[model samples]
Target chain A: MGVTGRAKRGKTEGPILKKCSTGIKGLDEITGGGLPQGRPTLVCGGTGCGKTLLAMEFLLRGALNYGEPGVFMSFEEKPDELVQNYASLGFDLEGLVAQHRLVLEYVYIERSEIEETGEYDLEALFIRLGHAIDSIGAKRVVLDTVEALFSGFSNESILRAELRRLFRFLKSKGVTAIITGEQGERTLTRYGLEEYVADCVIFLNHTVSDQIATRHLRIIKYRGSSHGTNEYPFLIDQQGFSVMPITSLGLDHPAFTERISTGIPRLDTMLGGEGYFRGSSILVSGTAGTGKSSMAAHFVDGACSRGERCLYFAFEESQNQIIRNMRSIGIDLEQWVKKGLLRFHNTRPSLYGLEMHLVALHKEVERFDPAVVVVDPISNLVTAAAPKEVKAMLSRLIDYLKLKRITAFCTDLTSAGGGILEQTEVGVSSLMDAWLLLQNIEGSGERNRGLYILKARGIAHSNQIREFFLTDRGIALRDVYVGPGGVLTGTARIAQEARDAAASTLHRQEIERKQRELERKKKTVDAQIIALKTEYELEREELQQAVAQERLRDDVVMKESMEMARARQADAVPTTAGGKQGRGGRKR
Target chain B: MIAAEGKRVHNGDGEQWILRLYVAGQTPKCLTAFANLKKICEEHLAGQYRIEIIDLLVHPELAKGDQILALPTLVRKLPEPVKKIIGDLSNTEKVLVGLDIRPFK
Candidate 1:
């Protein structure tokens, strides 16, 4: 950090606006590596919105992490009060003050005492700040509610002019400073300090939505550096202030070719033989009691089998409940939980806002370093916030998971009170790389669960609607049985198969009977044909004999005639006229 | 009003001791300053002194007029020269000496 700061400072005489890291979680990323270095950032908020804490954290973390001493000038709270208040967050203000690393200058002005009697130049405050900065060589300053001092001043113009001068003086001192202010009725701050300090302005808001309080931090405006403009939800816990910057890291995640199983072999088959892509997001959408959680448990068990970590976020069920429930289904999730391979994070959906869940989810994912993440029935989040906020939160969550290359499988219980199937209130399927839709096909006095892949972005996935049954062994998907009745399921399929088998047997018997009748008729026709052929042969033989006898008799008569003719011709050779007359008589 | 001469307000007829207390509102410090100034005046100046309490929040322009900066500043207008003491005047010796009622120890 010092190197970066020195590089920026030495490059030019003009202040090179370098970004300083605020060490607080998500704040640096939100501000694209923190506030502008050596520039005063205006931190304004309403009462109880954590403005002072924000400022104090910037200075404390600046000292702790970046090795830069900081100065805290409190205009509202006394130094002791500031120290006591921040002690809850592990910020050792007194220790730092004793070490001369942090200088706490309490500049509490009595609202009823101080009179703006003259055109004062704020020289006293400036002297104190310069003195503190010099004493510690501080590089950061926190002016906590500095505007409160203006309440004693009746002269608005001089105070305004002096505040501007104060920021410029701080900038010139080359200290990155945060000035806290009360939220104004119409402007960003009560006195509109934002108009003067334009380098950066942050707004902290604490509002109760649906009886649950949520704290939001937004970078209202940042000059010369790109910052997250969205209102990020933040939390104040034992670790101080943490702002959840949803989607501050954009959607440019590295696509991975690695794949993990969906826990169930059939499910893997449905998802193109392997599981989801390593960095892919898969959504299991189904109706009530469609084995979505079972599918998730299977995936968790599979990850645990691979000796990889898995984080299970259950919004609707507790850890023990999930473990016990999954145990009943032959998936011994408690074993993995005991093995520390699976971590269950359970929270009530109505406990906080959607962003709060997102923040918790991000923290748990990071803490566990899970290879796969499963949020059972993410559709319950629809109850946590507005549909749009829920979808936005989920989009951010999915983007984060994909960026980490952790295969994520989230279940959505497509609410029963819907007109369509596999339609979640959040409508997040578009962001998913694979969608496995489970449905309850209830017919013929029974309900059967069916699982199918609606789409798999890559690889050849089965288009068959497989009937999945949950039993003591686990979930099993039946092979697709598509007949003339299209896709069949449950007893109807069994019944139809029975009917088809019976009809085929009957058809076989009918065909055999017809074949036997055809054989008998062929035998009768052969006998009748034999009898007719014998009679035809006898008659043909008699006719042929009669024709042969006639031919023989004709031949004998011709031969005799030829002999007689020859003898007559020889005897009557001399008498040609008589021979011709005898030949004509014979021809007659 | 321009009173370059401090005693001109009394017309020099045994001159009324004029003391002005600058305050923002009726804060505790301002009340403390007022009480101390009254006690000092009652012990020394008696009935011959006139005290003026100017709330600067009511009149901000007066600040530029008198060149005042700190809060609860007690200004002595009489005795030819004006002297100022900042804070709630909690240190009585400092306040007494600053007002020229007594010399500094």
Candidate 2:
């Protein structure tokens, strides 16, 4: 089916169904535009469900914003009471009346004073309403709790007939009207006035869940128009009624590639050396005392240091408490607050329902128009609503922040005992663009904080776990030190590092001893070679001297032998010893 | 109605009943209601009653004073405790009872 119409500001289209803007935040989008134009819409709810206020706001907004005159005919409250009630909400009803832009008609009825005698019609009511409308030339009308007529009159059939005529008369006069009724147990309204005002039906509900009052608005039906059927949570505070349409926003927010700092240089290094992407949702989850708030403070500090506005929502701590605590860690948040670059919104989770918290966050973000938003420990919000609801609210919030291209840094406190520190109980981890898991590495009789990037989309983040310390200076991330057991931290890492240093020293001493032993062995081998060379030289000299002595003796012997031979009648030829000559001849 | 009106004796200084009949215009129901109210006042109240006709169509703003919603509404203005009766006074017995005249009769 096609949409009946879309309400555009200051513009109209042809033939489908023309819409009137309700001039309410997040309401016009849900109603597909506004109530079917020039037709009476039935708004039914239980007492104190804001039906009267809704109708009054419609008429007031019509008069103020849409430049359309309005007439408010109240059957439940007096004009003075209404004016006073609306005055607190900053609506100038009396001023509007003075300007002839609005007319407030109070229909007072006392059943005890009236006696019904015979046949009659509610022509006076019609005339009164018509006169009020004509007096201002109103294009919008509000009959707040018109079903009160049922109690004041005895004839139901005539009242019903007249109500039908009243609606027709309103349509004929081209005045878009809102007719409120008290909710019935089964039917949409007590008097079944929905049957008469069939053009549109809106149901307001004020229900208490876990003792938290949440107001919701649902469009039951709209003739010739399509409207949001989901019950959008609405808030009625000083700003009046504001409906929050959870699924109204689509996933069409523009993506930004700009990166911002996470405040800690090492943490930024872990996140691909730059920080979170602009317009990204960052989740920093950890157990208690794991410095989740500190991480968020750093993010806010980073944004403010860059001269960008930051909105910090502290659920667990007050503004002064956070400021003082961060000051202890050497981060002066008060200066940022003083400079108007940082804003702290502190509220307890139990102060409102999940939707109310979302509305407040939305209001703050819109008012501040911050470049970065930080919610320190969103896990506290689980106490206000269910995990699923918290996730839904966070999803809408992240979507809103992303649409505005605001960097959102939210800290979540994971339950410690038996609860996985890696798992965010609210299950909002998947909704975040970057998730930093802070855990307590309990070992060596002490607990130490460890931080690791679980996920960082579109960036190459570090996979190593860095031991983080919350020191007096700031949060410091140490490089991972793997020991015999695992990644050691605190004194265990220190002890292991000390042991490694000692072992390296022993190794250096052992190498020095081996070098001395090798030097001694080389010297001894050199001395032995010198001694052997000297001994061998002496032996050779002695052998040569012996041969020389033998030779000299032999010569002396030959000379003596020759002289003997000469003396013994030896020939003139050189004589040799007979035995020597015979031996030489025999040897030859 | 005449017998009942004659049987009651009017008492007190505020006994004069000043009734105002509010109507948008001269419709049949308005005329019938005015006629019936006049006849009932003359019979039941005699000389102690007075009827005032207020056309809401002519003086529409005056309807807020009597809190008039239905046409041809009768309001007992002069009595100590004012009373209001709605609808055309077709049933004189009910109308007399509403006016607190010949109520038991």
Candidate 3:
């Protein structure tokens, strides 16, 4: 249908259902275009649901923006009342009327003041509306609360017939009209005016869930056109109605390979040595006092330092408070704010409804056109809305930022309960492209911060849980040490290191003492050997002396014996003695 | 055309009754309402009555003065208190009661 419509429009094939722009922010996109041209659209809703305002804005926009004259014929409110009411919203209705671009007509109907005596028709009404439209050459018309005629007339048949004719008359006049009706219990309108204006029908609903009021707009039917069927949340403030069709921003946002820093260099090293993708959404979740906000502030500071605009949404703390707290951590955000690179929007989550908060965020982001956005502690928003609602709102925010190619840095505060510490209370973790989980590591009577990358799509991130610290200069990430018990951090690791050093020193001292004692013992044994050698030498000398003396005496004795032997007994005995002596020498 | 009969009087104080009839054009409903109003005035108010006819098609801006929305509407403009009766004045009794020609007691 979209293709055919575009093709027909491109060819200008004899007015193929030309669209009239509604001039409402985000509404035209939802309706594929605006309402069908030269046809009447029925806007029905319950009382106090902004039906009249929507109709008024449509006509006002037609006159002011499109340069097409409009006629506003109200049956419920007088022209002056409407002028006064719209003046607060910065819409100069009276000025438009003075410029001859708009016509305001009030149709007064009082059943008690008139008595019907015979058959009649609503010819005066038709003439009045036609005259008003013709007076200004109006291209747009708004009959706010036309259902007032139902209560003013007694004949339903005549009123219904006249209404049907009115719609036809409006169509014949080629004026795009918005006819508002009060919502009925069963039908879309009280008098079933939807049955007449069947070309397009839009329904506005105001509902209060958990004491928070939210307004929604839904296109019920649009003939010959395709429209978004989802109920979009709309906001009406000082500005006019703004519809947020977040679902329209599917997952088609451009994926950028450009990487931006997380401010802390070590943390960036943990995330593939670069940082989060330029348009990616990063979630920093942790328990209280785990430096989540500090981490986010670092991100904002990094973006600001790079000369890019950053918008910080502080839900729990005021601007001054955040500045003061961040200053303690050596992050001077005040200077960035002064330089117009960083903007701080501080509001309590309970100040407005969830949808209102979302709308405010949208407005601020649009105005600032920042390159990065930070929502410090999104968990506080859960108090204003249900967790499911918070998730939906965050997803919309993330999608909007992603579509704008703006990096979003959000902090989540998890409760210190038995629940999984890795999980966020708002459950927006799944929507984030990079998730950094901060935890409190309590051991050895001290609590220390630890940070780890839970998941980072399309990046090879470290799986180690690095010990996180908020130093006086900035954030510091150090590798946690593995002890005999488990991974150690803080004072426990310090103590273990000290103990290891002392034990190594003691072992070195003991080895030195043992070496000295062994050297002394070896010296003592050498001395003993020296003394024994000296004693042996002395003994040998004494033996030599004794042996010489003995030899002399033996020689002398032998000579005497030889003489005696020679004298008396035997030359044979002398020869035997000489051989024995030679033998003895050989043995020695 | 306006019809004026101010010479004859047949009511207390002889106060003149000024009746204005509003119509978009010369439709049958306008003719019937004019005829019925004339007959009733001749019988009840006599010469102390004046009927003015206004055609909205000629002067559409005049509709805002009387807050006129219905066709053939009769507005009693000069009876100290204004009274409006819509539709063609074919029912005489209801018209009398509506215009206070004969108050319902």
Model 3 C-alpha lDDT per residue in residues B37-97, reported as the tens digit of each score? 8999888787677899999899888887888878888999977678889888899989988
| Candidate 3 lDDT tens digits, A173-217 | 999999998999999998899989999999999988788888889
**Error of model 3, residue A216, in angstroms:** 1.6
Steric collisions counted per model: 2, 0, 0
Native-referenced DockQ of model 2 = 0.66
| DockQ per candidate, 2 decimals | 0.05, 0.66, 0.58
> Which model, 2 or 3, shows the larger DockQ?
2
Sort all candidates by lDDT, best to worst.
Answer: 3, 2, 1
Off by over 4 Å in 1: A1-16, A115-119, A479-488, A517-536, A562-588, B1-105
- Model 2 misses residue A13 by how many Å? 6.7
lDDT of 2 by residue, B1-105 (tens): 555555544453434678989987889999999889888876767687778899988988888787899887999887658888999999888777787775655
* Candidate 3 Cα misplacement greater than 4 A, ranges: A1-15, A482-486, A496-588, B1-15
Best by lDDT: 3
Better of 1 and 3 by TM-score: 3
- Candidate 3's DockQ is 0.58
i-RMS, every candidate?
11.0, 0.8, 0.9
lDDT of 3: 0.89
What are the root-mean-square deviations of the candidates from the true structure over C-alphas?
9.1, 7.6, 8.1
In model 2, pairs of residues that clash are none
The all-Cα superposition gives candidate 3 an RMSD in Å to the true structure of 8.1
